[model samples]
Target: MTSAEVTRRRAMGAGLGALAGALAGCSGASGPVLRLRLATGPEGGPYNAFGQALAQAVAASGHRIEIVPVSTAASVNNLRKLDDGSVELALAMADAAEDAVLGREPFPRPTPVTALARVYVNYTHLVVAADGPVRSVKDLAGRPVAAGAAGSGVQVVTERVLRAAGLSGAPEPAPVPAADERPLGLAASVSALREGSVDALFWSGGVPTPALAALAREMPLRFLPLDDYVGPLRERYAPVYTAVTLPAGVYGLTEPVGTIGVGNYLMARADVPQDAVRDLLRVVFDRWRDLLREVTAGARLEPRFAISTGEVPLHPGAVAHYRSVYG
Candidate 1:
């Protein structure tokens, strides 16, 4: 709770209110201006990039709608913002959002939010320098590790995966700088990995992440398999995790890496106008091809599985969209 964070929160609040106000007023001729505040993850991560792309798509739809993308720590942070009224729309991991509602780890109490769609799967990448000593999660013992930024979904999953692997205290979690100071979450971790500040990095993101890909090109790297922890993780946390493979050579690796996949959800405050949510869903599902071309991770948002939000309830607007499509 730094002054900088307070100031940023205030600015976001203003933007959300302004958008809500505009959406409240409409004329049959031009329609009302709809402004939405979308809270995304770290600056260089997939959440921020995909959110910006979504905003652009909504803008290009020729509707009187404008989405403002705000960069914040992903997952846990986004749900907090939604609860406090600073963010109208956001992206969160299915597990973290469920935790928020259940007042589980990473959340102090139940947070009310609604899901627009289950957008994509974020694969856990336990990356180490190819020449480094660590070959597996157990090897990370007594080493420094970047376990993801504090208050991020990455951190949430990182901790669970480690605990399930029996390495909960094996490595020291990297110190996270203040929110405003951390522009790119994984970029900082990658820098630490490259500089030997940390021996291994735990990142949860869509495949072919720009920062990781760039790091792979500069130096050899390898992804440690988390196959052993999948069942235990499911037993401890929500069942939102699934097994997935990282194709060989995706990040220039020699063999496919096994990892757990967690779904990413597009979320909103429950009070947001149902019609507005419906329209947003339309932009996402109806024009999904456009999103897929823009964001590689967008390909995971299969319409048939879009409504499979675990603990967090789907927004009424999302329900309407599905009914319109199916019924």
Candidate 2:
């Protein structure tokens, strides 16, 4: 192995040892194993895939902690589950986490959710049939569109994007009846687009999402440019959205497409045990490459990026872990 590979392996081994020691000290020689429920996105989505990989990696490290991945609507739903104490951990979009922590529209009151890390970036995808009538965001003014699952981060961003394009009204906390809007998950959205029930669909996820990739194979697909609305979205909300490009050759694209980007955060309830949180972060950082391979290829994770969760305060354990690393 190369020098870099050797260093990485050594770091992972040390992290595993720290985690094992921490867990052993917490639970005596024969204490019960600690199980944590992690709320992930819908099946077949990046969040779910990442959660599963992280869980497996943690288990393989020989730690006495079990991470149970729970499927749910992405982002918004995940934060709600974390807030209500239904799940100890959750993956959510940074925007959604900010909303939850600040008592924004979707959340009735400020939620006591803390961040574990800013895990990755999610690209907003506005997909339409190659030869469809909706060629741009404004073209969806009267066309039927799948606006993402009802309680998903995709839906929250979709509403804002639509509003920025002057194609929709103010976002409501609950889904409102509209002739052109359909609140469907990734799977259902793909089926609807194929069946001609929806003219377009919006999804925010890692590039080359499996469902979309499969759909690309069945027929031609076009990704409408969303970079133009980043400014408007930032003006209306916090500066949580960034302009990003979907590289060429992904999902059969001939050229890069510009879109809005948002960070994905791993969050936890405010009351979770500090040692548990620290142990989890150890595995996440040490095995981040495995997570990227399982979720999004070409994605990146590092101490700087992981600690950049805006507005969402890091958990005490996370802060401790980072301090130790920096020291």
Q: Estimate each model's TM-score.
A: 0.87, 0.88
Tens digits of lDDT, candidate 2, 189-279? 9999998999999999988788999999999989999999999888878778999999999998999999999999998876667788888
Candidate 2 accuracy as TM-score: 0.88
lDDT of 1 by residue, 24-127 (tens): 45768997877789999878678888888888899888767788899998888898998888878889988898887666766776666778898878889989
- Candidate 2 residues lying further than 4 Å off, grouped into runs, are 1-30, 170-179
The window of 10 residues in a row where model 2 has the poorest summed lDDT is 14-23
lDDT of candidate 2 at residue 317, scale 0 to 100: 85
Clashing pairs in 1: none
Error of 2 at 171 (Å): 12
